[model samples]
Every structure is written in structure tokens, then in C-alpha cells.
Target: MPDTQLRPLRAFAESLRLDQVNLTERWMRAVFHDTELSDADRLTYEQLSDHIPAILEEICGALEEQDLDQVEPAIERNARKHGKLRWRQGYRIDELVRELDLFRQMLAGQIVQFSESRPFFTRRHEERARHFIDEAVSFVTLTSIREVLTERDRKIDEYTGRLERANHELTLKQRLVGDLYESRMQITRSVVHDLRNFLNVFSMALQLMSRAPAKVEAALALANRQAADMKALVDELVEYSVVLGDNHQAAVECFDLRGLFDELVASCSPAVEAKGLRLTAAFDDTLSTIVSNRLKLKQVALNLLTNAAKYTKVGQVELAMTAAGEDQWRLRVSDTGVGIGASDRERVFKEFERATGDDIPGAGLGLAIVRELTRVLGGQIRFDSNEGEGTSFEITFPVRLEAREGGEGGPA
Candidate 1:
């Protein structure tokens, strides 16, 4: 309060400014040795200082001018920053408190050491400096803890909301699972019924051929056609079975992602050219090697490209591959021919289903295989179609597949 009271404190504050850098270094050295503050080791020299030099300047300003208002903003700003940074570095509350307390003790020691060296420095001057340091530390400590706790509360709220939303989604997924089970059972029944019908026709043709050798030619032809159809059906079903199996992941490899997609494009190029449709492919410049099931992914791209070519009467089949997000990639196969009918979209991925009708070749298992492979490779498949314009099947998957999803112990 008195001019004499302010003089020694101001002189000490000035002296502290001169040795500010050294003071910060000493504080950091003490912090590094403290067993309770392990997280401090992760911080660089600049970070560990926690802006102590700035805070000291503020303390000195307050002491010299004998006014706390001038330095309050600067101190509080530094404190908030320090707290937020420490929280991000994964420091616990106790560790934060202990670290700051160490800085406080260091400043307290500085005050005592300075007082001992100078004859003009008295107990009153020591009291004044100590009080200023104490006041500044309190402001910083409370503000910093508030910032950390506020951040913690916000994140907790966010996680809680996410959990609630996830729970609701899980419930919907369970219901969808039940529906899928029923749908699978229906597909099984449908396949069995078709097999039975084929067998009956084959039996009738055989009977006709045996009863009357005069008409054997027509009956034999019918029997042969029936046998071929049966074989084709069995073959496709075998393929479908293998594709839907869990073994697709056994082919996981970390290879050039663009190289594989480009290779797939090349594989389908001849066919696409034969159809008089341009086979165009676009890739992100950042496309690089990725970890995933290569063979299964190749199959997906091949099937999609083939179908795109098959369905397109004119225009081009386009393949676009790019990064979808920080850790995901997107591949889209689009056609410029007759797109899938809106009503038929639901059954497009169904076993023995075809949206473009019976004009195309092969069993309707192509799309089904694509869907299963997408699932096996941890991806989502969705199509955008305008009945006459075209259909684009876009699938987004992780850039790096986890070991379990990549089939652990399988060939990489």
C-alpha cells in the first residue's frame, strides 16, 4: 500500500524479468524430476514452460504498477491454453495441480533467494512478492481447472448422446437381422422349388423318350436342355455358396489399391470394348496401397464392371475410386444404359434375382456375389438409378482392414 512497500517488490519483479528464461528452465527441470508428473515427459521444452515467462511478466507488471487489472487477461488466457493443452496431452487433474504447484514453489524459492542476495530486500518485500505470486497462481489454477473440467463435461455429454443413438441403431439392426433370416429362408425354399420343377420336367422328357422311340429326337433334345439348365443352376449355386462363405477374407493383402482397380478395369476392358461401350476409369491422385481382401475386392469390381457393360447399350461404363474420408475409400461403378427399375431395387441383391430381367447371361448370382463380397470386405453397397438413365453402385470401405476382418492368420 505504501511507496516503501511497493519499491522492493518492483525491484524484485524487474530482477525476475531479467532472469525469466533461466527461471523457466529451472522450473521445467524440477517438473521433469517430479515422479507424480509423468505426462510432462511427453511435452516439448516450449510446452513444459506453460508460458511461465509470460506469467512472470504479468506478475512483475502487477507488482511494479501495483495494479492487478492490467495483467489479469493475459494470465487467464495463458492458463486456459495451458489447461486445454495438458488435457489433450492426457494429463490427469492431480498431475496438473501438482505440476503447477511445482512452478509455484519455484517462484516462491526465487523470491527467497532474491531477498537473501540483496540488503534492501526485507521481509515486507518478500511478503509482497509472495502474495502477488500466490494471487496469480490461484487465478491460473482455478481458470485452468475450469477449462479442463468444462471440456471433460462437454465430451462426456457427446459420448452419452452417441451411445444413446447407437443403442437405437442397434435395436433397428436386430430387427433387420430377423427380416434377413426370414428372407434367406424364403430364397432357400424358392431354389428348392425350382429344382423340383426342373426334375419333374426332366423325368417327363425321359419317360416320353423311353415310351416311344419314334419321337425320341424331340424328347431327347428337351432332356438334354433340361440337364444343361440343371447343371448351370447347380454351378451358380456353388459359386454363390463359396462367395457367401467367411473364407473370402483369407485373401487379404496389403497391395497397391489403384493397381488392383486398374487391373480389374483392364480385365473387363476387352468385354467392354466388344460391346462398343467406352470403359472409362477415374482414380484419386492420392490413391495408394491399402490393406484388404484383394481377391474379393477384384471380384466385386469385375462383377460390377461386367454388369455395367452388359446392361449398357450405348455410352460408357465408368469406374471411380477415391478416398471417401480420413480412413475410408469409395469405389463407384456406373453405367449409362437402361438403369434398374425402381420397383426392382429391393430384389437386386437377392439370390436368383435380376433387375434388368432375363436378357442378361449367367445366373442372377452376380449382384448377390457382389453384395456378399462387399460385406465380407467391410463395405456398404448402395445404388443410384434412373430407370432409363443408368445405375451407379457406390461402395465405401475402410482403407485399412483390421486383422480380424482380414481373416487372421491368412495370407497377406
Candidate 2:
């Protein structure tokens, strides 16, 4: 039998143990009454209420057993559930802890009310009840703190991952911007160099017109041609600046390849001859008219021929076109001039870069422009050179458009 003095404590514990569901439900209703919450938050609060009965039962058992450990699993479960759900619901840790504090306060109030209604419940019982409630609250507080820390660590990890990805993308963009800036600088230098070459030609033509009355027509023609060439260069600069990968294929047309070569040779041969250098053109028997960008091809050929004539002081400069395969053609320009050195070969194709070891009169743009045009034509260039002998450049391109046969063996 239970002692009469402890009777109230036992009876009170039994009441709470038996009526766990009603006690928890009433406490939750009172706590939630008149509280404004979002639908999601209210649903979470309702769900949490369902676990309260079991928690109250555990607390009652701990009071009977006088062992706080008996209530630990319940406290741990409640804390973990509240912590995780509130986190996902975007609630603050303090808010979740405050609700748990309210539950502890209500449990303490119920115990005090039960003791007050019974005179047999002593000061000793009251002290023990207060201590038990304090332990329960302390345990819950510790678990809530642990859960908040764990959640903080998880969020830190998530934020760290996003930051790393952003950093990588930023680095890649910086590298691309640096490369683009360097390319623009090179282009600017090349344009300035080409403009100066046009100025020199105009200056020479003016001098000739002023010196010789008989050369008036020839000087005017040279000036007109140089002016047209300068206009073309300006137009090309505009096109290149507007967009990348605009290969300018919109101007593509079918023209006689032989005719293009013949016209270019006739126009360029005089310059080479004036320098006392022989210029020869050779066309393969299988070569004929084809479909391509006529203006760009002519520009490439003219640049190559002019470059050869400018460099070569003696011996022959030759231009040749041959069928490399059924759908491939090669245009080659060989010059018996001051060839590029092995170490300087890489620099020769760069804008405003010239061959070494010679005082050549040039703006150093001819080969660079040729390289750019050849690339736009989807062609690759190869060079063979010896220091004293000569240099040969071969460009090969695949025919995208179907070819129509027209020309036979001819002096291109």
C-alpha cells in the first residue's frame, strides 16, 4: 500500500499518466488559441500536438521512477522533429524553442494546480515536482540547442557549395575577357599599319604626278586603285567588328577560278616586273572554274603575290593552283626572297609582325590578312622555307559548293 503522506503525489501522477491525451490536447488548444499562423505553420503545430500525449506519458513515468533518463528519448524525439520541421517551414530556432518552453510551463502549472488542490501534497513533493520540471525543461533545451547547431552546419555547407560554383564561373569569364582584350589590341595595331601603307601609296602616286607630265594618267589610275583598296579595307574592318564568326559567306558566288587568277596576275605582274623579279603562274590541267567567294579569294591571292614581289630581290616568284583531291584545291605562292627564320615563323602570321634580319619596306599586314581570309574560307595554310633559298606557302580548302567544269589547260 502507498503511504498516506505520498498518496496525493501518487494519485496526481496516475491522473496525469491515465489522462495524458486530454491533458496534452487541452494544453495545446490553450497555447494555440487566438495565435495567428500561416496554414503551413498551423499544420505543423497540429502535427506536433499529436506527439504530446506520448511525451506526457514519458514524463509521468520519469516522475514515478525518479530517473530523468526515462524521459530522454521523448525529449530527443520532440526536439528533433520540431527542429527539422520548423527549419523546413522557414521558422526561427528561437520560435521553435519558445513553443517548447510554453509546453514545459503548462506542464509545471498543471502539477502545481494538482498539488494545491490537495492539502496532503507536502512542500517536499512540491520541491521534487519543481526540480523534475526543471530537469525536463533543461534536457529539452539542450536538445534544441544541438538541433539548431546541426541545422546551421547544414546550411553553411549548402551556401558554400553555391559560392564555389559561382567562383568557378567568374574565373572562366575573366579568362575569356582577357583573351578578347588581347585580340582587339592586335587587330587595332594591324588596322593602323594597313592604313599607313595606303597613305604611302597615295604619297608615291602624288609625287609621280608632280614629277612627270607623261605619267599623269598612270599616277591617277594608281591613286584610284589605292583609294578603292582602302575603301575595301575600311568595309572589311566594319564587318569584322560587328560580329564574330560572320565569315561573310553571304557574298559567295560562282565565278571562273581561271578568270580570277588571270585578272589578279595581270594586275600584280607589273609590280613584280618593276622590281626586276619574274612572276609566273601555273594551273593544273584538272583545275577549272569553281564556286566560291570571289572577292575574298582575289584579295588573298593579291596579298600573297604582293608579299612575294615586295620581298624577292632576285630569282622567280611563282603562283600555282592545283587540284589536291576530287573536292579539294591548293593555292601555293613560292618566293625566292628573304625567308622567315625558324624561330620567327610563328610571329609572321601575327598582325603587324614582319620577318627578321632584313630592312623590308612593308606594313607587315599582307601575310596576316592572307591568314585571316584563308581561315574565313575554311582553309589551312602550310609553309616550307629555307633561310637563303626561298619560302613556299600552300593553302588547301575543301569545296563546299558543287563545282561546274569550264576551263582547260591555261596560263593562269
Candidate 3:
């Protein structure tokens, strides 16, 4: 008779002990099912269920205790680990909290269902079972929060550190103010392209976090990286305006063509992959170092590559540099992208003009920048294209720097 009286209390505790595997699976699915914490979808069932079974065991132990201290240490340890793991995995604090809150509700509801199903688990046992679940949940959430706070600095470091490369290199959507405003106008439009590109990535991240939680981690990481890119662009504005002023000469320095093209390949890889396009870089082994403005050279190469990668929806993008002749090297970028039309050819290197349709994303300034920079580096730029086939652009630069070459690239 006495054993029957204890049935209500021990029944819930015993159920937790025996049904932990199923309970853990339920909690894991709940996480996966949640819309706000959608990033959990990326995790495999095994990874998502880490430490859950053990945490349930601790909760079972806690339910049998007169004072909660007996089992809290174990719960705290596991809860803290879970928190750390999620934070490192790019979970927002609110998402983490929501995840735990859902578990607490699930655990509480399970107890209610158990008591209502069995005649022996009366109202008397129902209240006590709920109290134990509440205690376990509240304690677990508190421990998890403390661990999350401790790891917050790591996330901050990620934002302030060296910028990770951007996936889409050319988000070239900038609204020019109709008529060009000369040099200052050129400076403003130049940075507007960069700033807009970064914001586009951030916007994409927010959208993914809201609608497709499974992609939250990658989206957030990309946003974090672009934050640094924005900062760098801001810092460069002061110097950019000064360097490219009406009278000032662009700084000239020698740089290896091989090293520079490799960087462009890395930056453009993600965007190329998204279009199912193959991107390859090749330069003749005999090509030696070129004496030119490294900054102008990089900007020229980047603009051409970005334009090529962004417009080319399929096939491949290729960059190649080879020795053209005595003291000359030729750089070429070819793509199986939609080629420039006969009508589009007239606007190819004009400011705010594109060699493609209006629907495509471009600042229209990319080719303009490429043309001027190519001229300043003592290079001649030309291309051949067919409307449906693709385009090949080649720029040949003299190995020896010309005296007046540096002055040509400054603001028009």
C-alpha cells in the first residue's frame, strides 16, 4: 500500500531514466523543427543530440532529490558544454535561449501527459512532477547562459580580425546621380560600389537567418566578414581621395603578376562556383615582374575579373598572363558568359554603362575603372565578343614603366 502511494513520484523519474533515448530524440527534433532556431538543421542528428541523454539522466537524478544541489553540478557541466558548442557553431544568444525554453516546455508537457494517462499518477503527483521539471530546466538554462556569456569575446574577435574573403565579389548595384560630377563624383561612385556590395551580403545574411535557419551559420559568418570589409573601405576613402586627386599622381610600386592574380582567383571563386562555372588562372612561367602602380594594377585586374565572374552564368572564367614580346606582358580574362552585343559595344567603357543588359548587376563603372587603370599602367585594353558566345578581353602592358603613365589614371 505504501509503495502504491510513492508510484506517482517515482513513476515520472523512472520514465525519464528508461525513456531518455526517446526523450533526447524528441528534444532534438523540436530543435530542428523550430523556425527561429533554424540553423540547427545543419547539424546531424548525432551532433544535435550531443550531451542530451546525459543531461536527461542528470534531470532524472535531480527529480529524486530533496535539495537540487545533489545533481546540479552535473547538469551545470553538461549545460555549459552545450552552450559553448552552440555559441562556437554561430548560434545567436536568443536562438540558444529559445532552444532551451522549448526543451523546458516539452519536458513539462510530457509530465502532464504521463500523470493524466495513468490512474495511479493523480493530481497530487502531477504537481510534484512539474515542480521537478521546472527546477531542472531553470537551472540548466542559467548554467547555459553563463557559459554563453563567457564565450562572447570570441565572436567579437572574429568581427575585428582580418577579413575573411567575400563569396560574391561583385555586387555592383549603385545608383549614379544621372550626370557625372567630375573627380569628386568619381571618388564617391567608386566607394559607393564597395559599400553597397558589403550591405548586400549583410542583407542576404539577415534574410537567410529569418527564412532559412538551416543556413544561419554561414550567413552570419559572411555578414561578420563583410563588416570588416566595410570598415576597410571607410578607412581607405581619405587616402583614396588624396591619392587620385586632380593633381596628385597615383603611387607606383612593383608587384608580381602571379601573386596578384592568385588573390583575384580566391576572391572570385565563390561567385563562380554559385553559377556552376569553372574558374582557372594561368600565366606563362617566363612572365617576369612588372614595374607599375600595384594599386592601379590590382584595381584593374579585380574589376575585369569581377565583371567576368559576375556576368558569366555558366561554363568557365579564365585569367591568363603571358609574355607578349620584348619587355611586354599580356593579361587576358575570357568567359563563356553572355557576350556584349553590337549595340552594347559603344557603351562598354563609358561610366555607368555596361556591355550587357540592364537586368544584370553591375556598377557600369567596372569596365570604366578597368580602362583608365589599364591606360595608367601603360597598357592597351581591347576585347572581342559575340552576343551569345562569350567575351575575351586582353590588356598588354610594357614591362618598363613610362614617365607619364602614372598621371593618366587620376580623376578625369
Candidate 4:
């Protein structure tokens, strides 16, 4: 290779790199500034020039068929002589070919105009020049088309990726919705099962009370008492529904715990006597008033005493209350009955849960209601029991007295 031609080719390669560098800087600036670039920008800047061969074949078939002209021979020769000047410099080849085509066309036009003015060397030279110009134009057009196709392919790939991500997100959301629906259905089924048991118990009690009213008066009374227990169970279910349905807290007021216990004992005395269970109440009248829903507290105490009386047939059940601390009092209901198993103690507080099925005539809402009421009053209730011996429940509540000015210390 001659040094002269090699030096020019080297200079052209360097110039191409400089052009690419400048274009890259502009591309970065446009992206940072949030300026959108079009397909025309990609074409004009030669950004997608890698697909030049395919583009040239599509857009300029005449160039592929044409014999090597003087410029084509020179380009091939330089590519062979210097490896850097080969078609591997794809963008440079594309740009240079495009410029050559434009220049050839311009020269052909000038030659035709000059030949038209002079009538001597008329059509032949003009036709040959036009053919060369057409071939050059076709080659450059093909290169441009290939570049455009490459850009299109890149866009399609990006679109496909985005679509896949969207589908994945949709599937995740659908699974979450299905899980939520299943959980809701399970809760509904459990509630329905509990209701069915309570209804069956009420029906049986009503039928027994109607049959042999005089001859089995004691049994009838027991049946009626069981029926009343079912009614209370239903009422508690209603109350629980109301509490969970709304967001309102229970209305609290200062109340006498001792007085509340007195009312509960009086109300449950009939049931206690009927069951042959001895009932007793021991309290300190000096106990402070507790801040709570008075009606709910009374219901809790009544349920505890009834439960004690129901379980204990021959032994005594006692309701004892005393001041536990400066601002709290403790109430304990102890009974000598067939006590709960350790494993069943916690389960007893859940709705429709019982230690023994078909033995105890209860829908299992007593302890559940007790727990709910205690929580509503900001109090705590706990129990201790030995199976076949007895059980004792201790309840604690904060004190808030209204008539703390004057009161005698005595059991109500």
C-alpha cells in the first residue's frame, strides 16, 4: 500500500470516530433534557448504521447488480490494503457511500446541462452518467432502510418486555384477591355451624318442657333452664355481631362493683336453689367504683354465677369481691364442680367451644362473652381449675368512685 492513500484512510477513520463521539454526547443531552428523538433523527445521525448491508439490498437492488465502477474498485482496493478501511467500519462505509452517490448525481446533472447546450456529444455520455448516479443512489437508500429496520426491532423487544411485566403483576393481584375471598368464606361457614348447634339445643329443650309437665316437673324445669341458656347464647351472638359490625367503643361510667354483684346474686338465686347448689357472696363495701359499662358488667357476673351453679350440683359456689389495689378491685367466683381440662381452658373462651360435647347443655358462648365484656371494660379475667375438683375465675377492674364522699364499709 502507498503511504499517501493509507494516511488519508486513517484520517477518515479518525473523523468517523469524532463524529460518533459528538453524536453520542448529543444523544445523552437529549435524554437528560427529556427531548424525544424520532426515526428521522436515527437515520440522519447514522445511529443504526450496523444493518447497512440488508438496508442496501432492500432499498437499492440496482447497486447490487451493477458492475464495479472506478470509485467502487478504488474503495475495494483501499479496504484490502488497509484493514481499518474495510467494510467492518460499517457506519463509515454507509456515510461515505451516501456522500459519493450525492456527488455523482450532482456531476451527472451538470454534464447533461452542458451537453444539452452543445449539440455535439449528445445522448451516450449522458445516459452512462445517469446510470452510475442511479446505482449510487440505490445503494445508499438500501443502507438507510436496513438501519430503520434495526431500530424497529429494538422497539419491538422493549414493548415485549413491558407486556410480560404487566401480565405478571396482574396474576399476583388475582391470587391475593382469591386468598381474601377464601378466608371470608371460611369465617362465614364457622359461624353458620355454631348457629345450627344452638338452634338444635333450643328445639330439644322446648320439646322436653312440653312433654310430661307434671310427672317430670323437675326435668321440665331443667329443660326450661337449658332453653334460657340457649336464648342467652343467641343474645351473645347478636351482641358480638353488633360489636364487630361497628367501630364504636362501649360507653363507660363509674359504678359500684359490690352493688353490681348483689344484683347478679339476687337474679341467679332461683337457678342456684333449683340446682341444689349453695350460693354465697363476700365483699368489702369500701371497694372503689369501677369505670365500665354497668349493664355489660352485670351480664358478665350473672353468666359466671350461672355457670358455677350449673356445674356444681351438691357443693357450694361462692362469689367474693375485695379491693385489690389503690384503684382496682378483684372479683372471684369459685365453684366445686367437674373442672375444665388444662388443654380446654383456652379453647373454652372461643365461641361454640366446649370441653365435653353432649354432656354440658351450652352453646359455648358464656366464656367468650365474658372475655369480650372484660376487654370492653379495660379489665382482665383469668381462671384456675383442677379436673374433677373445682374451678375459680378471678376478674380485676379499675376503680372510679362517684359517691366516695360518704359510704359505710359493709358487705351489700
Q: lDDT values of the candidates? A: 0.83, 0.73, 0.75, 0.58
Instruction: Report the lDDT of model 2 for residue 146.
Output: 76
Off by over 4 Å in 4: 1-233, 243-246, 401-412
Models ranked on TM-score: 2, 1, 4, 3
Q: What would the per-residue lDDT of candidate 3 be over residues 1-412, giving only the tens digit for each residue? A: 3666655667788887787788788888889988998779888887788777778788777666534688888889999998898877778778888888888887888887787688888787777777877888788778878888888866666754633323122222122223334545766665687677778889989998999989889988988888865664554454334433535455566778788777877888887888889988897988767777777777777777877877788789998988998888888999988899999898788756666554554345677667766766678888999988889999888776655633763232
lDDT head-to-head 1 vs 4, winner: 1
Clashing pairs in 3: 38-213, 39-213
Judged by whole-model lDDT over C-alpha atoms, candidate 1 comes out at 0.83
Tens digits of per-residue lDDT, candidate 1, 115-227, equal 89998998877887788888888888888899899889988999999999999999999999997898688668757866777788788988998898898998888888777
The digit string of per-residue lDDT tens for model 2 on 1-412 reads 3566555556767978777777777766655662533322455446657556656666676677666787788768976665666666565666666666777878788778887788777778877776776787767667766777788889999999999999999999999899779878877776787778889889999999999989999999999988877776676555434324543343556766788778978998888899899988998877776766777678788878877887789998999989989887899999999888888787887755778532454446677677776766667888898887889989886655423232111111
Summarize candidate 4's per-residue lDDT along 1-412 as a digit string, tens digits.
Answer: 4554333223322332444444344433443333232222334334333333222222222222334353454333332322222223333444444433443444355446556665643465446445644665454444434444555566589998998998898899899799668755644665566557666756665676677556466655655766675666567667656544534556667766777877877887788878888888898878746776688667778778877876786888988888887877777898998889988977777766667655566556677667776666556788999988989998886675332222211121
RMSD to the native, candidate 3?
26.7
Least well predicted 10-residue stretch by lDDT in candidate 1: 403-412
Question: Against the true structure, candidate 3 has what lDDT?
Answer: 0.75
Question: Which residue pairs of candidate 2 clash?
Answer: none
lDDT order of candidates, top first: 1, 3, 2, 4
Per-prediction TM-score to the true structure, in the order listed: 0.51, 0.51, 0.43, 0.47
